[model samples]
Target: MAPDPPDDPYVLHARLLAADEAAFREVYEAYVPLVLGVATRVIRDRTAAEDVAQEVLSHLWERPLSYDPARGPLRAWLLVLAHHRAVDWVRREEKRRGLAAPHEAPRGDETADAATDGLVALRVRAVAAGLPDTLREPLLLAYYGGRTYRQVAAELGIPEGTAKTRLRTALRVMAAALAAEGITP
Candidate 1:
């Protein structure tokens, strides 16, 4: 018996790139659930997740040519991009809420807490700086940005599997690095 033919992502991409609405719709319908799943992981809000998914689709429509088969599969690429964008959105939202940064220091308590926060920030920055862009970006998007694995995949423009693998690898390496610095999660 013959094996089923592999789905030609490049052909599909070309059709979508040509602005074939039906082709675009097909891709959207096929992938929205996956995208939403990833977005929700990051934003932790249904509405925002949906919005991010839509944005991801819009980006695909606008720049279909950006999907390069030579680098990796199309699904991975889309998911990575989604993940990155969703995490960015979440981070921005957190900043807007003032949950991430202190607004003003209380006389005595503020000064004490500020120093600790600064120290942690410095350590985190140092660790992050030490990471290559591949690992650092994904880790930041997932942990700091609050995006799901799928969302991270979309943001990075890689496959869901690749995203999962990268996250796992990044976490292990970061854990080891942090442990050496006496930072325990």
Candidate 2:
């Protein structure tokens, strides 16, 4: 039997469910340039973008069930996937570059430290209460519970970069509020 023509994206998508070789080839050939473009725009490096594009396409090939034609067209879905992969790559690179500082807890003078810690806790609570839940939750998990950023992301069901960004925003808001009160963390 002759294999079906690979012109229609919907047909190709359906064929992917069976791990069809022709459909996979058609998808890669049709979308590689577009996916590479989106990844490069976000990553700002052609070589790394090519890696991202390859990973995204390979993910589609390996986990074809992850895609939903009902959500949107395959092209748009590929673009979104490529973009997310690119953003993740950029975030990883930023961390590798030490662009963000890690937060550390303070310690000293046990008796005096307890008293000052109580006051600081109250002030932190006041500032945190003013933040939106989306920003506040990850911050609390990472700081109060002493969770790693990745743990916070997993606990909150958010992307790791989003968790990091929200935590940064929350800290900034708290810092501004503390500054207005003539205090610094």
Candidate 3:
């Protein structure tokens, strides 16, 4: 997980708007992983995700006023930006590859993505792969392994509340990832 932001967003936002290098660095250190993680969950390419993270952070540095403090917190705003950028990156890649739509099947000439099959399947794998082990293990066990949450708690030796929270966090992560991809899940 990314470290919490070093200071209140408004303070940071003000410093950023003034082009403070220290403020930018602090924001980068605190949130780059989170931004990259979101991008990676959608993109599934380390290089591409790193590019997305850089673009997002650079946008923050170059146009800090674009982030409005009135509407929401800076962190949520950054996540939204990251999501949009990742989706845009995927769309651009698909277009460049001659695929008409994101969900459309890749052409026969295109590489098979190592037998991953459909775009949806690849995206599912990406999202699953991006989840933390604490979240992913229980998610797979409960959903794929057909275990109850109580059983998940017992198996992981965690309290039931922790199990439930993990499940909830996992679902939220999936939902956010899918939503970023413009999928209704």
Candidate 4:
């Protein structure tokens, strides 16, 4: 289980946006495991998962205002980002692997693919339902739908800072909820 961030998520997020490295470190330490878990689940490669997790965190640092509290919680937003990056990595790998099999039939592993997709969808839905609507929708857009934070803000008609605050609040709520469920976020 990851330790909770030292300050409330909103305060931590504000600090992070202001270039507070220590606050950013707290966010990184608290959520890296959850992000790595999602990445590993998709990529099935430890090294690649680590790389992707770093990339996700880096993205957060570069675009701290993308997280919106009104749209959903922060954990979900980060997980969604992790998941999308992992999926993108997997897809790129598939493409690379496919290039070596130009003469082979398309990898028609339909059943397995369908099952995996179904399971991911179900889990995402369950997690989203567990979140308040304010945190759920924006996180979903950024994470699951692969929209950028700017895009999410545009769609929600809110300023980017507000979006980030919503995202942080959402993450705090999720962390608490996961704790209650005997799970760590």
Q: Give the alpha-carbon lDDT of every model.
A: 0.68, 0.72, 0.75, 0.71
lDDT of 4 by residue, 128-164 (tens): 6778777887888887889877888889998988778
Scored by lDDT, the top model is: 3
Candidate 1 lDDT tens digits, 1-185: 12112447777767877898887877777788867776776667889989999998898898876655544445555565666666568667767787655443212224323433454455566667677888888888998999998999998999989888888888788677645433444
Better of 1 and 4 by TM-score: 4
Candidate 2: C-alpha lDDT: 0.72
> Candidate 1 local accuracy as lDDT?
0.68
On residues 71-103, what C-alpha lDDT tens digit does candidate 3 reach at each position? 445665676577667777887888897876647
Worst 10 residues of 3 by lDDT: 108-117
- Per residue, candidate 2 scores C-alpha lDDT tens digits across 1-185 of 12233566567777898899988887887788878877777777899999999998898899887775543456655665676567668767767887645542222225333433454565567668778999889988998899999999999888999999999999998898655433464
User: Distance (Å) between predicted and true CA of 20, model 2?
Assistant: 1.0
Task: Provide the lDDT at 162 for model 2.
Answer: 94
TM-scores, one per candidate: 0.51, 0.51, 0.54, 0.54
Candidate 2: the clashing residue pairs are: none
